[model samples]
Target: MSITRLSDLADKAACPRLVVKVGSSLLVGPEGVRRSWLGELVEELAAARARGQDVIVVSSGAIALGAARLGLEKGGRGSLADAQAAAAVGQIALSSLWAEFFGTQGYPAAQLLLTLEDLEDRRRYLNATATLTRLLDAGAVPVINENDSVATQEIRFGDNDRLAARVAQAARASAVLLLSDVDGLYDRDPRDPAARLLPLVEGVTPEIHAMASGTSGSGMGSGGMTSKLQAAQIAELAGISLAIINGTYATPIARALATGTGTLFLPRRKAAARKAWLGGRLRLKGTLRVDPGAEAALTRGSSLLAKGIVGVEGSFERGDPVAIAGAEGRIVAHGLAEYDSRECARIMGHHTSAHADLLGYAPRSAVVHRDQLVLK
Candidate 1:
């Protein structure tokens, strides 16, 4: 991987699809919403749109704004119920504010609330990706946030950093910009006089992770340098570059895209065609335990046949992503299922010729076509 400053970023032209994450600390304040800052941010977004790039904002502020509106204290002391309540109330306000700002610029805006499960579940993941693609194609900017109102500790993403990375993958974005209170990653905490900012990062190494302060934000946000590093790692795996910049800076988004003003973490390398889609990002809806014959066929680059599938585990839909396991229960591949769980169960151990008689309709011979399968 090559590391370069922001100066080189402008030369490559803006990415076709970009995901920008804005922290709660930058959008909210003790006095309420920061109108001036929001207006500036809107202008920046508009400029990007004018350049023909699709932009998605993964915003945080609902919980903080809701807490303030409900007269609750802003800190970790709040109960789970309290946090949920704040998110419920604040989401409306947050969405309204964003819609209003983008509306003024003549751009339509849509709200998307997601939980970790939404991205993990195969059906839901496809649905989310479809919605986002449709919205972008329709020239609408999507303002996404975690469904904090219903998210529990087990279901919550906790911070928007990782959520932004997931959004990038779902949207197939080329890059991600994380806007936070601090400018970028530093050799040490910026509070330390001896600390220096690292403007370009080729990869997130052990040394880089060590530099994280692991300190949460002062107000309503939960992200720290540690979370940003985690976000960078996710982006890297998805073949997306990520940048960390101080949201407080004037025109931060524009500056980051045009001049590389933030700390840019490059992807390790471009992902292989199959890995880009059915890789680790997708949640496995079920497992297909294939017989030794089928496993050998797969290894030889052949399509998966029903005769080779000895067992099917879990319930899933036809288009859902599932794990393909060998005789020993070790996952050897993953791909989009051509048949649903019930259909697979009925046809298991049978020849491909029996598919039409079993299901009363013939779609294809292979249970999973070679085109969709990605061997691990």
Candidate 2:
């Protein structure tokens, strides 16, 4: 909450705070961990570091990096266990490889492994933000990768594209550079003469989605134009700028950062959208009619207390999302109503401590807890 309004960030930083995600297709070539690619990336990243830019790399070459180094044929040629084993084995070498390359450039790199669960939970989310900030503060480029050796399909990020957006949000980055083999988002397959590259996107409109054709490039990755659009939407929602450009091009990222040459995705209309999406998590299962005083308190960003409930409507279970409304009929706040609708109805007009003996057992003190409530 103390972070800068992402929509208000300065245009492309003199020392840009960036979360750069590179897919496997661009990381490794027909041989493996293409020295040519890694060589170019290291020099550019090091230069950025020297200029005082903070960079966090959400890299995807791990699985492929692991597979190729382990001498496994294409990614599918191995079993799940085989893949995990390969990743476990390859990650060591992968980190060492990056560590040495970065060392050679007189910069230090830190390997930060993450899973989807790390970002989804609120407590873990805060902890992760703190850790990444501290790392960047200490001047270490965080080389983030999904903990693939243990992540199952159900708990997986599915692609680094989405992970990169989340990372950008966490880092409060000015932009997320999605470096792939393609130059930018195109109207059709760019390989075809009919396809056209879109230079700018205002918001993620349907037309923008239309231009997002399917996957193109070489890799064991499933991220296509569809996933890139998904990442773009995520970045937009967080009010972070994003660029999808070809990593294969020489000095691709440096050039984009210098002139905003790649496709520029404008930031979202933040305050309103943030109020709608990040502010509303639970579906309303019932309603609570509050007195004028409680309504005023809620408007000032206070939690809904037990004494506020004049009446509870409809059947809603504990932890179910509910709406708080005033006597004049307007929503005050959206919250997780603590007690079930039946129990809430029983204690509607009573204070929290007053309900214990009447029901033979004490229920939750507050009608709705603060942590469960999201202010409008």
Candidate 3:
């Protein structure tokens, strides 16, 4: 992997799809929601959308808003029930605020509350991906937040910074902007006079992780620099660039995109997280033997069509990882299967036009989409 660091942030030209994470400290306060700040932020996002960019916001303010409404302390030390109740109450207000603000800019905002479990389950992951894609295609901004009201301790992400990274992975975003309390990562405690911000991080290493200390935000927010570092690592591995910037000022997103006023974490590649996982980590549950024409098509970066599939082995369902073999049973690639084993058996050696007649319903055109395949 290339460890190429940058002295500045990657410009908007480099990121067509962006995820911006807003912390509670920036959105809520002792009184209530910071409407002016949120309005400004929405304006910046609207400018991005006008430029033909897909923008998603991962916001964290539900619990804080709820706590204030219920006369509870910020960053509650109460039982999980208290927090969940706060979340349940605050979620409506939070979503409403987002809708109200974005609506003023003539942008429709959609809410998506997800738990870590949703991303971990393969079927749900794909479904979430599809939903996000559809929302973006419809020219709406998705406002995502952790499902704090329903999440247990075991399933809770507890912080929006890491959640933003995971959301970037799911959305195939090109960059993630973590707009929090601090401007960027510092060499030491930011309170120290001698502390200096690191502008660009090529890779997240142990030494880099050591620089981050305890949480640095207001009591309303849960994540500290530690969670941000963890987020950077996640973004790096998934080939998505991430940046830490303070959103205390007006038009911070525009300034950061233009002037690189933050610490930017570079990705290992320009590829999406799905491709990276398919290429390396996932275990294969089955195999497909394809004809020589399909083997050549794969080498040329084409999708695997049913007409090229000669044999299917092992019992696997749709979205399961499977290996593709060519001549002499040599493995050529691995990918997520679009159809189950029985479906593959029925559709093998047939044209895509014949799929509906054989399967009783029209399915995906390719057995393995090029985006989901990793060539060996």
RMSD vs true structure, all candidates: 6.7, 7.7, 9.8
Query: Per-residue CA lDDT of candidate 1, range 1-376, in tens?
Result: 2324453332226467778899887898779899889989998887778878789999998988888889887432289988899989999999999999999999999999999899876568778899999999999999999999999987788889989988888888878889988778989988899988888898788799999977776656787889899788767767788888878867776666565556989877555534554654435789999999999999898999889999999999987888999998877788788999999999999987877898899757688888887765
Per-residue lDDT of model 2, residues 1-376, tens digit only: 2123222122334226878887777776677677766778888877767766788888876777777767786673267676776778767877887888888898788998888778755467667889999998988888888888987766778788888887777776767778877777877777789877777777777677877766645656768887888777767666677777768866666656555445767755443432333332223578889999888887676767767789888789997778888898766567777788888888877777878864678667588876666543
Top of the candidates by TM-score: 1
Cα lDDT, all candidates: 0.82, 0.72, 0.83
**Model 2 per-residue lDDT at 122:** 49
Weakest 10 consecutive residues of candidate 1 by summed lDDT: 1-10
Ranking by lDDT: 3, 1, 2
| lDDT, residue 272, candidate 3 | 52
**Model 1 misplacement above 4 A:** 1-14, 75-77, 255-260, 272-376
